[model samples]
Target: MEGDLGWWAVPLAVLGGAIRVSTPILFVSLGETLTERSGRINLGLEGTLVFGAMAGYATAVMTGNPWAGVLVAALAGAVFGLVHGLICSMAKVNDIAIGIAMMLLGTGLAFYFGKPFIQPAAPDLPSIPFGWWSDVPQVQAALNVNVLFLAGIAAALVLHWGLRATKPGLILRVVGDSTDAARAMGLRPAVIRTMATALGGAFAGVGGAYLSLFYPGSWNEGISSGQGLMAVALVIFARWQPLNCFWAALLFGGAGALGPALQSVGVTQGYYLFYAAPYVLTLGVLIATSSPNRALAGAPGELSITK
Candidate 1:
């Protein structure tokens, strides 16, 4: 019985850690999934997340309502996405270069705007209660999950079904897989790509909003720690499927939690190394999945990177 119990404990602990760590990744991964599915890559998602975090936290502090902060953040994100889409679509700029520019612009904007609200307190979102169901502390800890976490899973499921089972999803996939095919079918590739990028940005903004308004309230320049950038790599690992994004996010989250989990038990010798686990895992997955000899399976053929 002792051995059996011990074997189960590791998996449960990992599950808990996955949920705790996956929330931000889930949002970013989902957003990127949508963007990539439409045959365009928005590298500026990192900027969108940071700017959204600052905008959301500042609005919540000023208005005393968390929902208002969410709305404002979405708007800010959408505007940023529009700019990225417009510039890329215009044929005057390169997508990768534009993405890098957007990242710098976003960080600068967040730092500049976040200067004034650095000290104000804001209303934060509340977590759901699951602690009452279990008497054991470990069980309770594992079960106590975030509402956003569940919502993200639900969104992924819905998106998965929509992409495979719905007409609009079919259109998006067609455009992503082959712009020539989409054009033959009379679908406007640029319009669809623009909309997809905007929607992706909005979702990324919400992820940022979650970071500032809930996890670590009170805005600072260093609020986000590169979850946004990693999310791009995650989408490729997820194969642009929303359901896969959910699982991939959880795995990334678990890798991220490893460092802190070790620190909790007085094992801090390689703290920085453990902290790099997520990136290492991400790189590993990318190398494993990305092969020059064979094309990325299920990749949208029309995507610039894939071709």
Candidate 2:
């Protein structure tokens, strides 16, 4: 019984870890999934998140309202997405290249504006009180999970259903599957793609807002450690489905939290390797899901990258 209990502990810890870490990944992956479903890829998500974090934090500090910060961050992300959309939709600029450029611009802008608020401790957002029902410390700790994490999962499920069972979802999928088909259906592919990109950016921005306001209250140059970019690959691993993105992001988040958890237990030698777990897992999932022949098992057919 003792040995069996020991075996079960690892999974429990992993579950706890997942709850703690999945929020950001959930946001970024969902955003990416939406963009990709419309046959456009916004590789600049990393930058969008970082800048949004800065903007959100600054706004919260100025307005004394965390929700305001999130709203502004969404707007900021929308602007970035709008730029990416215009560039990709108008000129011959590749989506990937534009995404990279947008990332650099976003990061640079964040650093420039974030300098003033470096020392000011802004008001933090309150957490949902799930811990109220738990007596055990461990259970309480798990229950005291971020509301954003739960919201992320809900968003994914809802978005998944929306994309599959709703008319708008069908239209977006048609646009993603074939521009010619979209035109035949009298839908503007570029417009659909642009809207999808903007929506994705908004979600990514909110995810970034969560990072700055909730998890690590306060900001610095090193606030985000690449969770944004890794989420890009996460969407692929999730097969571009919002619900799948939730599970995949949770798995990645759990992998990410393992290193710190191990260190707390006096194991510190493999810290770097453990920290790399999410990226490695993401790459592995990508490899397993991707193919050299035939389209990605579930990828939208008209997507330029997968096809």
Candidate 3:
């Protein structure tokens, strides 16, 4: 079993897979972090992610431009976020329920419209080859990093800085902390939240674009695999910090790659158990960090979960 992949290649495979798989999670979690910072949770990003995947793939296939597809996917995601924000801004709407509804709606729309593009091949996003200096073929393959992954890292750094140093960031924090204070300051909480959610959705859409236009490079109904929903838990694990979100995403990605990495090294024993590593890790983190007596440290004061 190990004839093809040397034992030495196992760590390399795992590291490579972690970087590849974590890209989507990083983008989605960053988006969710932004939304949560505005005191709102968007559970429907799963649907948005799937929908964006479909839209991106279809656009690439039709236009023969992967970047265009990414843009369209972001727009589609923004539309979904805008709808969610508008509905949640109403007096009696439940953000969670509305998010669920949006998820269903976006997913349904994607499946319905994406049927035609499923069998067609779409243009793939380009990658940066960083393993040219290595003589090993496996090393070369492992280090062929996607452009989106690098962009996600840059985004994390920019977001972390922006949130801590920018005026808009301050406004968002204030609005998230207290609606009453926002009102007293003549700021519109609903509008601020709506915009934030839209921006968040755009980020998620880009993540979906990466999925369809890069790694897996395909459009399918089952492509997401709960990554969108998992991102919500990831945000909590990160304590709503963008930098933490980046690290948490990489950790989750590493857990996800454990099984495949083990198999590469001929360690197929209990392979199925390895497949469950990511979920197990997430559950363990949630359980270990949870507290019923108080909100999580660093959580926004106006977030529904905190109340």
Candidate 4:
């Protein structure tokens, strides 16, 4: 009835929008965090992300099942990750450069094949009406959280725990810390890294699926809007902690929601500028956190940034 809560609506909308907007980044950052944790980095996840979006949308359209699309997306992402991992495992290979190439390749493939699905409508993933109790339409709208966002949160918690308490996590950390040490322990660093990278890619694919199956729900080449590449900065900002990635995703999500939130309240003065909030926030964080004398506290030792 009375959705007119005046100024209060802005923050409420932002909160809802933040949860909605954060899902993809949350998934991508979690995936990238795992990749980095395993002592490898994939700049190509942006590509994987786009490809996943295309695959998921196409599948959903064909099957009339949103879940099927998500599954296919994850599988497709794993393939991309597998390729990236294999290439980077080679001696003297630069992960960043390879990542860039993969990004272009993924985008190219999506654009070419995604043409047919451009106009087709697909079933969207469902959302939880958390604000079902609210009488205000804005509150109800804001509280309609997606299931993937919940999954992302659960995933973050599980990842954080798994990293600290699991045997495989220990081995991964050992490999990530030093190839020599891992070798001495009779572990295969290349293989481990490759697997980690692939799993990470799967995570990224789910993120892409969220895009096409949910918020801004559709198949498009530009759906990702660089959220995949920003995974690196997000991971860095989160200090490689999975739980932190969750919070960071929300922060980024809220920043990205500023424009729409303000516009809903008839504040369009700096609409375009508000849309850039996430980027500005990212740049500010990077600049502020950067240091010439010391390395990031918890960065994997084998990661190039730490070196």
| Residue range 163-267, candidate 3, lDDT tens digits | 999999988999999999999999999999999999999989998999999978899998888899999999998999999999999999999988998888778
**Model 3 stretches with alpha carbons more than 4 Å out:** 1-5, 292-295
- Candidate 4 TM-score, C-alpha based: 0.98
Per-prediction backbone clash count: 0, 0, 0, 0
Which parts of model 4 have CA positions greater than 4 angstroms off?
1-3
In terms of lDDT, model 1 sits at 0.83
**Candidate number with the higher lDDT (2 or 4):** 4
Task: Indicate the residue-level lDDT of 253 in model 1.
Answer: 87
Measured against the true structure, the TM-scores of the candidates, in listed sequence, are 0.92, 0.92, 0.97, 0.98
By summed lDDT, the worst window of 10 consecutive residues in model 2 runs over: 1-10
lDDT of 3: 0.90
lDDT of 1 by residue, 1-307 (tens): 1233444555566677778778878987888788788888888889999999999999999899988888898888888888888888887567778888988899899999899988988998666757777666766776677777878888899899999999989998998888899999999998998888888888888888888887766688887788899999898888788988998998998898777665555566988998899999989999888776653777788777875
TM-score of 2: 0.92
lDDT of each: 0.83, 0.83, 0.90, 0.91
Alpha-carbon shift of residue 159 in model 3 (angstroms): 0.8
Q: Report the error of model 1 at residue 15, Å.
A: 3.5
- Candidate 3 vs. true structure, TM-score: 0.97
